[model samples]
Target: MATTINEIIRDSLELIKAEHLNLTPDNYAKVFCKVAKQKGVIVEDCQKVDKYTKKLDPNIVTDMKRFNIGNIDELLAFLVAKLNRANEGDALKMVNTLATLTKRVLQAITLLHDTKATSLANASLERLDFHQNLQSIDLVKEKWFDFISNYDDSYLKKLDAFGHVTKDDLEVMVRDLIKILSKDDSTELYKTLVPLIIASLSPSIASGMNDELASISNELRNSPDALGTPALQQEIKHLISKRIDLDKAEVQKKVAALDKILDEINKKILELIQSSNFSHEQVKVIKKDLQSINFQQDSFETVQVKLLNIASSLESETRSLSEKMISNQETITKLQNRISKLESALLVAKQEVKEDYLTHVATKRALANEMNRVEDAFMRYKIDYTLCFIDIDHFKMVNDTYGHEAGDVILSTVGKILRKYIRQVDFVGRYGGEEFLVILPSTELAQAIHFADKIRAIVEQFKFLYKNERINVTVSCGVSQRSQQKSKDETLSAADGFLYKAKEAGRNQVMPVL
Candidate 1:
């Protein structure tokens, strides 16, 4: 019988939970490493942070137990709590690294899933007579509802939730799968494995192809077009691991060694000419003769013993070149890894300046980024843009009445409302709790007021329901345009001042009076 993909996912999740009874950062990493090793995924010391496990605080384990990072529903709550007291980067890394390691666990599950399918298919064939097997194989095949209800696609989202996965990670994962499945001879499973492994490797090949990799890619492409055999997966690991080197230094050294050999012949010729007490013309003739005894296919060495000297030099250079090429390949491999590290570091930096985790709008850092662009436009073209500083009226009441989770829902909903209603050219970002910023380009003061008023009304009318409790939400906006402000800060201050005025006058209103 075909098992639902969710059953596999649930089992996979349970397996992780079972691996370690306590799911703190330290225990999580330890369990992850163990699971990966058991599943045939190789981990270099450079890729792990096991040594840091000793440094974890005792309090974190206790706190994590209360929050229960194991439960998906409580995950955000745990993160929100951690972010308040922990180093921001450390908190994010704890989440991101856990997600990344869990991907390895999922890859192992995929391999196990493949192995199970293979065993079942083989069993079905052997259990039946040949003609009966041909007709009854539909039992092995999947059904329509199996396709409809299966949740295999959630694995991709689950993997991407906390970390930025790369092509190299995918290739390594697929390679492990291929190694484990190498013994599976079932033609049915071979068809399944070929495409999955190929798909895993496709992104790596497509994204990072050089001269040598292109040839391998063509071979992989050709294999799928043909039998789509199990052997295709077998060869993919070898193809991806191939590296080439053409060492110019080795070539130059070889040429220099040959030159030294030729130079020795001239030295000996000069000595012979001097010892023989030859005339000046005879010395010139000897020089010409030695030069003529060149290292060429058509030439012959008159000194029979010199061939050994020249041959020895040639052999030495060949050995040196071979050694140099090996060294170069190793160096290139390390360089590629270093480049991946640098790219990953760059990704970390980019991740810092992104949408608000709680609200899903532009974070404060992102707001500053957008402001810089808006400033650039205003300076260069003298273009005008409006900035509206918004504060949710009586927002503290929502938190007081409905709880923080409901408040979070209201915040996120308001962000979505402002983000959705704004022009694409405009910008909307969450400034802080209960505060938002919106920028409208080329808009007059009246239009800015009208737009802010419209958003205020939308938020007021829209209902936010959390845990069977309904709450009314409204926002007060203070509007300012860039036409008169001297700088970005001044424009922001003007909007902020008006926002304060609006709040002072009464909540739930737009402050259009400059």
Candidate 2:
């Protein structure tokens, strides 16, 4: 009843095929063991491999299971392969760590802001880059070692002159320098400002404060340095307060004098009514109202109301009195109309200065104001913004070929598009001819670049028509974030530089190509 070895072998081959397993040695041995056991033959267990595998690390045992490593030879090969991969990974990690360290070192050197340090950092960067491209970590390490060993830190001593060269120290130094300069400037400013303040005083007000004004002016001119002391500053503030009080008193005095003049006129009118026999209901009403008027109130509104009521009563009285009153009323109305016209003209002039006539966006003056506002916000709150410098491509050519009118239309259209797309918090302005500045508050550089690209595409696709002729138009944009630069002007200049790059690369594109 026992199976022969050849029959067991034949049965193992058939079972392997039936089980849809590969005919490898491990599969054959396992199947052969199974077949022999079924035929009542004693067979060796293939599970003996597990005893050795269990003695290995759990991770290795898992790998053996995964890779089907049944024998010692297979296990050895897998272990070797795993070891090779781990070695490669560790080498990569070491190289990355070195690169990161080198980068950080270069950044620190750059922050020193010294010419020599910058030169050394640049050279090191070049060498690091060369080694990194070659993937030779040993060479990189050697180069770094040589840089450190041969590096002369003598130049660093110069930074000690700046007192530790920290941010706080630099800020303190700047403050001290500004204080000194401001003190010098203040002497001259006080000399000029005090005289101007004195000259602006009205004659009535000036009479009362003349002695104080003359003394302050003489002190400011002759001993301007005295203003540096706190005592002198307090004295000047006291003088200013006295001048304000004098002005208020002068205003009240003038109001009282006008009230007296009105009272005299009312008495004269009442006398004329009584003496001329103009006895009517109008006369009674006017008499009653004038008598009831309280001139002692000393308030302008009360006087004006009383005057208006008397004028209303006088107008209805008689033709002769009415004619004279109408003449006076016409004169006053003309003066008021003239004043209103002047105010309206002033307002229009101011608006014209702040807004461009053709584009309806902010003028360069307004843009400057907005820039200052944005910068103040940035410096005070660390709230960042971005500047997008935009220029119409081939603008000069458009002007030359299609006339300046067409160019104006293009400029106006571009400005409108820019203004339309921006958020309410953003600003768009005509920086100059064919140039616009868009300020994106709280925007990152990447977001600004995206916004600029969107605008560029919109401008390029727009159908610009002048005199029924289709004209091609496009724009180049340069964008920069405020925090990335040293100052507002530098940020603007950077945006302009990027714009130049965009134009040089090709028109109708955003610089930085993000």
Candidate 3:
């Protein structure tokens, strides 16, 4: 029984180390939970153990008395208590609360630092220092207090507008702030932050417009020309209600119409001015005729004043009309241009959805679709097809040693190499994680293996870099031909089996010994 306990503990720690996971107290607690559960034991309040200090040592978790479980028996009892104390959901909630509070304090510190509020930044950092000395529950409470106290009224109002603050809202705000921070303009930080907060108040004006436009389209399809239909006169009380939501092309057309309206208004106003000159000419003739009839001075002056006032009022009204027309035209043009860009972006996004964003290759869903197509061609036409599964060796170690950003760079580089080297007739896709699939149509195993070995050799010799540091990497591939397999699934299974064989025979080599 002691030997069983020792082996389990050793294997769990080794697995965690192999995965390159941080051997923090929380991770250690989790390991204990796993082993205890395996031994048919339940641990309650396991989160309590997670509160232990995150001291960096892979050995500490497996053998420390600081976690209050020095022996195997004590470990089992502790695990049972931890697991049974509360549900996993409650534990997750606690963890999220801690994370959110910590993030908020960090953001406050950043904001204060940018504003040259050195004193405030120091205080915030001191509070964090103060946090480390306290218990986990107290640490969380301290962070919350620091976060709420640090922000001013304006920031609070923004938070309030988000409506009953939650972790999700904080996460959104944090993500947006981080994006803005990349611009590195500290002067307009608050200015930028405010709009982002308000923008999050709803689904988005453009998205709402899209939905309204779709609804109108549906309504028209059911009864064609909904506005012009006489039967629905009761529904739309006004003869010309208001601006209706429209698509990009329709918006551009409306913008052009608005431009015409502006031009016509300007022309009519100019024509009105020309007519005023004619009116003045008529007034002069009237004055001459009145003088010939010996009219009174006071009467002539009064008539002239009335005509001048009328002309002045007409000119003022026309000027206002011209301004409005120009303003409306400019607004419509800008909106139309914005809509065109948005539609173009949406099209690109839809295309990207079908591709593996990181790899720039077919996504898993797309690969699945291609697999079905290839299988159909094989079954119907008896065409030969081969598939190779490729996996990167020691990918986790690369991530652990260099960082996830470096891992991403390496993955993208590998993807680029695969795409560049493969034939146009063959299809390559990211199967997921560090794995890729190369689907060869009308090709035999011999041909597939040759291609695999070539790719393997290229990757082995390829010089990869992440942050100016050179990194070496290799791939192991399993090649299989679809000859006797009953279906696509069976063929893939055989390919996976060979891929594992490649890994077992020492990575950086292809399967089937050649």
RMSD of 2: 21.3
User: Candidates 1 and 2: which is better by TM-score?
Assistant: 2
- TM-score to native of every candidate shown: 0.34, 0.38, 0.36
lDDT of 2 by residue, 1-514 (tens): 3448789889899988875667998778777877776877765464556657778888777767766565556667887878777666787898789888987898788776567567667766777776654445545555556666666756546655534343335567566555554554676676555444433331334357656655665666577577677997887778777778877987787667656645654565555444444434455655555556444322244444545444454445443553344346564455346535644664566677788999999999889878887786566435578999999999999999999999988988887898789998799899978899999977889999999999989999999999999999999999999998999989999999999998899788998776
Clashes of each: 0, 0, 14
Ranking by TM-score: 2, 3, 1
Q: What is candidate 1's TM-score against the reference?
A: 0.34
The alpha-carbon root-mean-square deviation between model 3 and the true structure, to one decimal in Å, is 34.4
Q: Residue 291 of model 2: what lDDT?
A: 57
Cα shift from native, residue 137, model 2 (Å) = 64
Q: What is the C-alpha lDDT of each candidate?
A: 0.60, 0.72, 0.63
Name the lDDT value of residue 68 in candidate 3: 56
- Residue pairs in collision within model 2: none
What is the C-alpha lDDT profile of model 3 across 1-514, one tens digit per residue? 6777677678779867875557877677567677766776545554344444244244546545555553345656655666586776887898778856865766676664345344544555565655555475455555545655574646545655434443345567566655654655443454333322222221211232434333433444354334344664443332112223323445565446435533443444444344543433443443343334322222133333433333344344443444343435564355346535644664565566568889888888778877876785455434558999999999999999999998999899989999998887689899979999999976778889999999999999999987778999999999888875887998899888999999999999988765
